[model samples]
Target: MLLQRRALLGATAVLAAPSLARAQAPSWAARYPELVFAIIPSENASGVTERYGPFVNYLSRRLGTRVTLRIANDYAAVIEGQRAGNIHIASYGPSSFARALMTGAQITAFAIETNLDGTKGYYSVFYVKADSPYQRVEGLRGKNLGLVDPNSTSGNNVPRFALNKMGINPEQFFGRVVYTGSHENAVIALGQGTVDMAANWWNDEQESNLLRMERKGMVRAADFRIIFKSDQIVNSPVAYLNTLPDELKAAIRTAVLEVHRADEAAFNRIYEGKQGPLEAVDNAAYEPIIELNRFVDNLRRRG
Candidate 1:
């Protein structure tokens, strides 16, 4: 996704037609010369950096500042980083973002990721080995369950919510619940027989954690079957601190919104699949998820 500087620009002009030469440099940019951008490790650390490095470079050029990418070990680290005002910007799963705000992080969502279908939502699903005796959620009772992370939307929050909706309590229902630390690890655990089933995100047949692993030859898609899938959850978002100046927020928003148009290949590289244009969104978009987290939190409290 690297682009050489020349008469024709590739990702160099993601937000600026000429490296932000025309727009007035904001005071906030000078004060915060370098911005820390953290992301949850949906994949392994190196894989995450490889996937987002180009997009980070493009964002730096567009914002006329240095942007360092921090691949968090877990979702809580990202939420804490932003809460402490250390991470200037972050990419978050819906539930993690909601948790951040619920825990009193002063941030505002600027851009929402759109799926290839042009929808602003995805689903949480349960997966088991295709040959496993577990044919449904009921069959998985008394068997161990693998989850991505506690702060994860699809992997944690939504799965619990889905189970509770079905009158199932994860702790009592599953023989044991294990936190695999990531969607990748959850599926890996399933494949390795560390758990009977796992929870993850699925957006159509073409996009999912399973497909990504399958493409990398980590897991075969045919080896697993989805036993349950929750209702559509809000799409993930990229947000900035509320403390940032309005102009800086606008700059970040513009850069994100124009990413696909400014550099098709670079944008495509970030997703590694089909994607729709970015949508401008706000905190209101994730209120339901906050409630979902509240529900999950209460469940944890009772347990």
Candidate 2:
């Protein structure tokens, strides 16, 4: 009878082990009742909120926690917020994400956006007024230029790298360089004659900064002309703070990946796509930007 009892107890323990482990697992929902989601200010704050609010709400319902949307005023704000642990999750530009990682921020990129045809990249374009005499990047020499941000991949880093590769130094080549803070603002500055030429992003489907503004009647296509366009740069990333428990991390990843299926139209509108889906990405995917960052850093240090 003792031997039989011992065997039964061992079997019961084996059956209960998985459940015990699961029950002992840390619950982020319990510890973190509210999670802050920060987005890079690709556009104005109000515009960012209006576009990303529904997506945040969906994450809240899917993760079973209250998620607040934060439209950071600039790229650095989002990076600093994540570094300080105030922002739980962030949609980061590639260059900004590289900067965040280099700065020792505890975060991991989980997903990246795609174009309407499922391409996973976009371009940096240099533009001038439609009637401007600038026919090439060199033609814009000694003219005032507008850049989005130092941490912007398409708006700043790529353009700088491209010019450097072409044997041109942007700081010395342009008469004056202005950081417009946001892509839309950079375009607006060009329209308001604040800068003779501007650098911003251009999507594969032609649905990006300039297009968004045109849709809202802010600028017309004919208002600007693309003088230079850089090679494909990977789309932005959605990253979560690594401080979250493993279970919560998995939940957040699942929620984001499944969001498109939950509301395809809303997802498309948020991303300005018709049927593109988010795909898993990692640090390796951003190596190009990392290289570009190094080049830009060296260039700055030399100046």
TM-score for each candidate, following the candidate numbering: 0.91, 0.89
For candidate 2, the TM-score is: 0.89
Off by over 4 Å in 1: 1-24
> What's the lDDT for residue 265 in model 1?
73
- TM-score of model number 1: 0.91
Query: On a 0 to 100 scale, what is the lDDT of residue 106 in model 1?
Result: 100
**lDDT, candidate 2, 1-303, per-residue tens:** 000101000000001111224455446545877778888878887677667777877776666667777776678877888888888899999999998887778999999988778889889999899988889888878889899988999889998888888988888988999999899999999998899989999885567678888887888977898888889888889999999889998988988887789876558668666337888888889877887888899888887
Which candidate has the highest lDDT of all?
1
lDDT of each: 0.84, 0.80
Tell me which residue pairs clash in candidate 2.
Answer: none
Residues 106-174 of candidate 1: C-alpha lDDT, one tens digit per residue: 999989999877899999999999998887798778899999988899999899988998889989999
